[model samples]
Target: MLKSTFLSVACCLFIGHHAFTQCIAGGSNAVAPYASNSSNKGVMFDITATNTVTISCFDANLPALSVGGYEVYFKTGTYVGFETNAASWTLLGSEGSLLSIGLNLATPISVPVNKTILAGQTYAFYITASNPILSTGVLTTTNSGYSAITSNSDLTVYGGAGITYPFGTVTANRAFNGTVHYILGDPLPVEFLDFTAVKVDQSVLLEWETESEHHSDYFEVERSLNGIDWNRLLTVKGAGESSVKEIYQKMDDNPLDGISYYRLNQYDFDGTKTSLKTISFNNKVEIGENDIRIFPNPIIDRFRVFGNQSELETLKVFNSVGEDISGSLTMTCHEGFTDVVFKDQVEGVFILKSKTNSQILIKK
Candidate 1:
């Protein structure tokens, strides 16, 4: 009876060991019949500022899959690198346990992954089997497993002036077999704070101030005939600072025939650039005829004119005491408007006259 009992105990131990090995082998080499060699089995995700995305599993049997240990990679043109393990992937929803056979059969598992991309940059995500034995059946063979996927997630990333990315993609195996995709976004607009044009006798002076700059590389002064097909007049460097005020100036002496439109081209420090608000003025100077009308007669600071002409050859103004006062006034012709500012003249009645025209003014 003692011999029989010992023999029974030994047989039981052998059976238990065999069962354990079978379970491990089955789970590890279970012939992922659905394993796909096609590159399409991968997925890509695009994220921008102020957005979020969720990744989930389709198989109900694959729970507690090893997602934490998987590696992530990114491709930006000729540059390629791996993402830092810090916060690279987040586990969302519920966490399940390992299957009895060492396989993960948790299905419908959800994981939310999010990240903000800078303007002109590209990004994506990837996953690999962490433990061959434990993750055997974690991935599926169906379209849900072998196919690539993407989500509508966006995060906001701030970029300096003129910074942009031309090409980017996400790779699964870091080879041509990985998925390829494109990213989309628009740069923030440029703000022009104070824009003014002063018309002096011989030229039109343009001046403007900026309250803030975004991706500002430089600025180009553009002129247009009918508000279309503009020609570049001048290029000004941009101040690449956010929320900081900047000042700029330009001059256009060669006036147009009709209404002239002027605009600012705000280029970022990078190659990218955008246009600012456009200002228009009419250049009406009669080369042979003069019909000039000066406004703001009680002139305290500046004055303007309404006329039908092409140019102003000369202008003269005298105080009641016959003292020359025109020296203080600076005149410019824009389209059909003339801008004049008095800086040195004193308060008194004055006589104003152009080459072919004359008028009386009272300054108080």
Candidate 2:
């Protein structure tokens, strides 16, 4: 009787171990609107650890009788180009021998192990067919429940080819791409619900709220005068770990004379840090100068001049005393953003002249 009991327990342990090792693939149940059109598009996710990152499972939609592998890469910028070029890339991992595929089937193909990644830097990962001869599976796409931080990374894609036609950054409302499952980095500790900055008299007030916190240590408030040079202002305690909403606020008693930038950094108990988005505030400034949107209002040498491309022809800047400053105005337009760059400009208020309108632009 004793021997039989011991054998039964051993058999149960073996079965459990075998089941855990198998990879289960997943994808959208029905046809979705998004599809992986080409190799120049992928999802961008930040590596949460410094030691090593592992891609647990890879899922894809393949054609019938497909047999090939994928080459995974880590890139800095868009899906392709100098940033995605071989000179500036880190080969994370690769896998082969993915065989016996069916028509339009979404399944977990392979699991590659340890690839080194930085702790706090942003990275984009893409998968390409190992060989061009065989049919390959692309990351099937979808777009639901994509608002929060989930297993899905932000979907970024590129459309152009070669050195001349650059694949500009275009964020689409689609996810459910390759490798939906990850056993690599730790989960994001805090989910920010809302973050806003308001100017109250001489001081600026910074406020933010989080939906949940896990193993969170504290919040470090950083201030910047030019949005480039940052300085630590204060630290506020977090909820440690909670599922309820938590509200936090900090006052910048010594806001700069003009415009200032504020950003939040959340730290975990184990020294893991994540940066929240940045916001700007102006102490004594106009909300919208003459019904024109002049952001970072108290400009720090650089600001954008937004206007409908067809409606506006030329953008010029003049000093506070109505003198056109001696400098070059470079304007670049892409993806509906027109940035007016200024060179050799001094601090103070100015006027931005467009074809049909003029706005007061303050420089700090």
Name the candidate that leads on TM-score: 2
**Candidate 2, residues 46-140: lDDT per residue as tens digits?**
23333223333455555457666654544554333343233244333344455635444555545332232344434455555554465333443
Per-residue alpha-carbon lDDT of candidate 1 for residues 317-340, written as tens digits (9 for 90 to 100): 777678765555566544445566
Instruction: Please tell me which predicted candidate would have the highest lDDT against the true structure.
Output: 2
Ten residues in sequence with the least summed lDDT for candidate 2: 10-19
What TM-score, over all chains together, does every model reach?
A: 0.30, 0.33
* Residue 98 displacement in candidate 1 (angstroms): 69
lDDT of 2 at 228: 86
Model 2, residue 292: displacement in angstroms? 15
Estimate the overall C-alpha local distance difference test score of candidate 1.
0.40
Clashes of each: 46, 1
